[model samples]
Target: MNNTHLHLVVNHLPIIFPVVGIILLVIGIFTKTEVSKRNSYFIFILGALASIAAMATGEGAEEGVENLPGVAESLIETHEEAAELFAGLSYILGGISTVALFASFRNYIFSKIMPFTVVLFALATLFFAQKAGTTGGEIRHTEISSTGTSQIIGEDIKKESNHHDKE
Candidate 1:
């Protein structure tokens, strides 16, 4: 499949997988199950890898779509910025997940702290995830963008163009 196609398929994983992982982690914490914790860690790691894939394909996706009608560079820039934030947070989560996985295996003395730490990280990750998703959606979804909820950067050009057209 093309890079845009590949990106569409994998981009959601970073947004979705960590949510599932967070749930599993919470359950693991509540139930005191190493298996669940391990699984959560694995899921987070996968999410991180997927984030890399999505980031790698992003340029190709941009190249494929940036010139299309109604596709604003501002929207792309917004999405790109949000994506960078998401990716950085996701990588941190991945590192934490790996450490937590190992901690589960060895029953680390400070193991109790890891889950709480992950929970905090997940919350922040989730915030960025939502931002990325919304900005990315605005890239093409005019319905969402029409409400002036647009996070698109460089919007002045769009406004100026619209104003000129109306004259």
Candidate 2:
């Protein structure tokens, strides 16, 4: 498939993975189950890997859509900036998760705290992910943008009033 198609397919993984990981990590913490926490680490690692793929395809995706009618360059730039931050954080989280996984195996003292640390970093990454996702959506789905939504609402109201006047 083309880069744009590839990007659309993989872009959600980085965003969705962290949410799943966070839930699994929280469950592990509450239940005192190492298995659940380890699974969460794996999910986070996958998310980091997916972020790399998403970033790799993003430029091509941008090129594919940039010239489309109603696509805003500013919105693409904003999405790119946000995606970079999110990907950076995802990499860091993945590295920490790798270390934490090894530490868990060896029963290292730091292992006990690493999960909590990873959770915090994952949360931060998720924040950037949300920003990136929203900006990306705004690039094509103008209905969700702040100004676009208001304009749509205004147009709908005008249409409704016109229909009533016609009746």
Candidate 3:
């Protein structure tokens, strides 16, 4: 409905697509299949595009959540920083994928070497994606947050008791 909602919808794309890409790329390399590797590159390109969409919607999402009673600005900021890094990695992967795609189609010598670099990039992207996902979860999912989990549970219990007393 809103930017924040859109952000939530699209955020997982950046995380999940790379995983599929990595798997496909590995399988392609192992089996000597150009089509699978090309598909992997295409997925990486899609993931990079999704990362852009996510980042575009992120500021509004932050605005929506930052003032919520249990949300922390610090967590949002951390997530933002992590998202930036993740997006950068995606962009780099996209570039490599493009080059590899072209090289593969042309049967260039570089295509043979591209998979190793792609694996490195994919691993790096995967690592940052995990960090981004965790930090993003903590933005609103207080139960999973490092600092606020216990406090949030305590607050929930207190609220329940207060409601019972009033009833």
lDDT (CA) per prediction: 0.89, 0.91, 0.92
**Tens-digit per-residue lDDT, 1-167, candidate 3:** 99899999999999999999999999999999989999999999999999999999999998888888988787888999999999999999999999999999999998899988997889999999999999999877877875878777888999999999999
Per-prediction count of colliding residue pairs?
Answer: 0, 0, 0
Q: What's the C-alpha lDDT at position 143 in model 3?
A: 73
Q: Taking the tens digit of each residue's C-alpha lDDT, what string does model 2 give over 1-167?
A: 99999999999999999999999999998998999999999999999999999999999999999888666688899999999999999999989889988888899999999889999989988989999999889888877898656655777899899999999
Candidate 2: give the clashing pairs: none
The 10-residue segment of model 2 with minimum total lDDT is: 147-156
TM-score of each: 0.87, 0.88, 0.90
Which candidate ranks first by lDDT, i.e. highest? 3
In model 3, the Cα lDDT at residue 77 comes to: 87
- lDDT, model 2, position 23: 99
Candidate 2 stretches with Cα past 4 Å from truth are: 148-167
lDDT of 2: 0.91
